[model samples]
Target: MATGIPRTKWQSAPHHIQPNGLNSGNTDVHLSYEGKKPELEILNTPPANLRQLWPSNAGHVTPNRLYYGDNLPILAALAQDGSVRGHVRVVYIDPPYATRSVFQSRNQTDAYMDLLEGAHYLEFLRERLILLRALLADDGSIYVHLDDNMVFLVKAVMDEVFGRANFRNWITRKKCNPKNYTRKTFGNVADYILFYTKTENYVWHRPVEPRTEARAAKEYQYVEPGTGRRYKKVPVHAPGVRNGETGKPWRGKNPPPGKHWQYPPRVLDEMDARGEIYWSPTGNPRRKIYFDQSQGVPVQDIWLEYRDAHNQNIEVSGYPTEKNPAMLQRIIEASSNPGDLVLDCFSGSGTTLNMASHTGRRWIGMDNSREAISATLRRFAKGLEPMGNFASKLESAEREEESEDTLSLFGPEETAKPSPAKTDRHHAITDFALIAQEPGADDLADAVGQWLEWKGESRIMQFREETVPYKTGKPQKLHRAKRRKQRR
Candidate 1:
């Protein structure tokens, strides 16, 4: 490839096209270039150890946390920390778009992924892909985002690194409206996203549930024969134990077919007497589940949620690097089950963690940029307003025990300081380099790393470690559990 763009200018007169010959050296046309700046400092102080970069929980945890650091160093730390090994279900990265924009950090060499003498930008992402693949669970998937410029190149490397056989889909998503450029023939209308699965057995959420018309017409078509009352049926079984002292069959002629009864004989008799049991003319029994109980269509993967944060984003951060929430939500929803740990090492503006928590998934977010970190924290604060209503119900249960300790303890302090609002990643890295060189942050860094791992929900699983698990063939009630909320 040509090392760089050559200088050029159009001659004013069409007939004077060859006039450029004489004025060539002293012509208005001029080439552009730059002298080098100091970028890399050979680490006089030993480079941060790769093994210790990760906090304890990095290799494990679903619906995990976000981490802020040089992603490459963090990846090395993960190689040892093992927090993500065989744990990640999906990887969705909106990698740098290869616009050849500036990338600066304390160590200048860290920024030069592709700006070298004979570098191909694709060469940069290749090394990261190797580790990212290692961290993926056997049955996992990955999605990589790019623009038209490098889509094909990135795709080929992804195929090579992750195995072409595991290829999933290439999505052409509408990124924005239009752009105008002098030499450009076509205005960019969209960019592309490449999806790949780790293995064929990977789990994928089907956005829609199937409806059997036969069942729908028979049960959900609740137009009564005579009274014409539109009442849908629901199981009449009152979940727990029943029947005086001994639990007996209640909902039907049988107790869930396999398990012991939920209610006693009398209650079962009462239910039968009330016609709660919808029996065929043959006297067979079954329960009715209504139509109104169903929520709307399950959310699909094609995201239309967050727009480029122009006006709305200013309402958010007005930051250039802020990611689309709709995109973040889709990634979180599709890859993680509720309560799973989610991590965003890049953690720009905390969009990933914010959206994850909004959907009830736990998250970890970190950013070298204090601005990004503060932006995320504020966004999360706004989110807490909605969470307050949902959590208010639970607050009543815990209040009596911790009555003296107020909710204010959970709130942010007046001293909370937000980072600079819109520093780019380069400047952010520069600031972090300076901070890393300074002395006081060791304790704070460790604390920040640890706090990112805390998800209050993990305590329950820890508590249950000693208890014997329930045995098979014993009936268990799973009524309260429904389809976990799918968000995007």
Candidate 2:
């Protein structure tokens, strides 16, 4: 709990190297539990400080947004200003599950959460969730997609952040078909989506279908009394009586209990003549709701819509990390009506934004990987539809000083050429420890050898470098400073 530099660790140094934000230049650095294995990166920022992460221009109305940086810093930067403060309607993230599977691009393994069981994974979600909660609207929702490995931990964190009363539902998603994982415990066929709302009365729009077959079977199950088409029936009455109208009583034995006719005599007569009315068994008259007429069923917590991207020709772009659009479409439709903004900080493959497009919602997405960002840009560019209202909205909003893109991931410039070679150039590095994944004797020696020759020249022992080996849960790399001299 103690945040200050301890006297033991403080006194060891001449007192000049401590961070100016924490230890005053005069505070002796004494070695303590914190000092023995202190975290180097998490400095200066106070955990208690509530950061206000918001978009810069409030007037920009473009439905698309992509950020290329750490969500933490973005949140921290937002803390100083509340422009985007308290305005988001929904949020979704697919964080690293702490499985510790290092993602590789060119033989360099990126530090990712090891999905194997661990506590650090939970803390990571907890910290990010806390920041995310601050950015939510009063009546907003958050959906976190996680695996069995850390679902419980992530859920507990959300319960604490959003308050237990706001905890909505744990969504059971069919990720991999049971046929594939039949050998594992429980077949490992599904993943979990933890839903949390900011308040009880959050945005609750019922989902309307795109005239899909399943909905056709469900809502359009009944038949019209006259047209003989499958149709759902609705009572055509209100609870209260109206004024100045001849309330039409159809060839009916009075309206349903406590209800009055919805239309006046003339309108009821017209509908009756059109044969849109259905005489109920109770001798009450109702209206025929056409099958081709109704929207989709209200989306539920249990999702079965999206299938993971497997085929390259599936409009999925088959990027290394593409999310199913159906999954996000449901989330967007359920939480926001048309034109409302949705947020996806970990917007890998732009599923959230893509769904926003199909469903007519506005959205913003952000990610740190250049490859992922490029993929998203390419997806949009490939579509090549005229920007239309979405583009006009963006321009008008900017004129009005509204929703502006702060770190515009894409500027006026076109896409850059891909990195020519995907191979690990493995330039000679002096301190191989600086480039190692783990501190194994084998990889460490190999890594150092690469660093030394990292410059393409033969091994050089005294080149100045910037990186110190990170404390990667193993022996830290020890690269004492070397004197740099001019080499002809």
TM-score of each: 0.46, 0.52
TM-score of 1: 0.46
lDDT of each: 0.46, 0.53
Worst 10 residues of 1 by lDDT: 426-435
The prediction achieving the highest lDDT against the true structure is 2
Name the 10 consecutive residues with the lowest summed lDDT in model 2: 429-438
- Model 1 deviation from native, Cα RMSD in Å: 23.7
Best by TM-score: 2
Q: Please give, for residues 1-488, the per-residue lDDT of candidate 2 as tens digits.
A: 33443344344536455465555555422222211222223222332211111111223233344544555654433333343446678888887776657553211334233353455555555556766777678888999998888787667667666878898889887563334324535545578899899999999867643555665767677865456788777878766433445333556445554456888767988998988887778566778877765664555665554545431113443344455665676688788878676888777656676667666666667665544554455454343122221234554565344322222222222112111111223121111111111122122233333433433434443222322222111121212222233222
User: Residues 1-488, candidate 1, lDDT per residue (tens digit)?
Assistant: 33332234333555544655645663332212243111121111122221112122222223343343455545544444344556666666666667756443211212322232213455546656776776677877777877787787677777767777788788765454233332546654467779888888876764433344554555566655564543366544343333353345333354443233445567657866865556768765655444544543464434333334431222344334455665666666776677665555556656666566656665544444544443443444332112123224455466344443322221221111112222212111100111111122232343333333332223223211211211111132211112222222
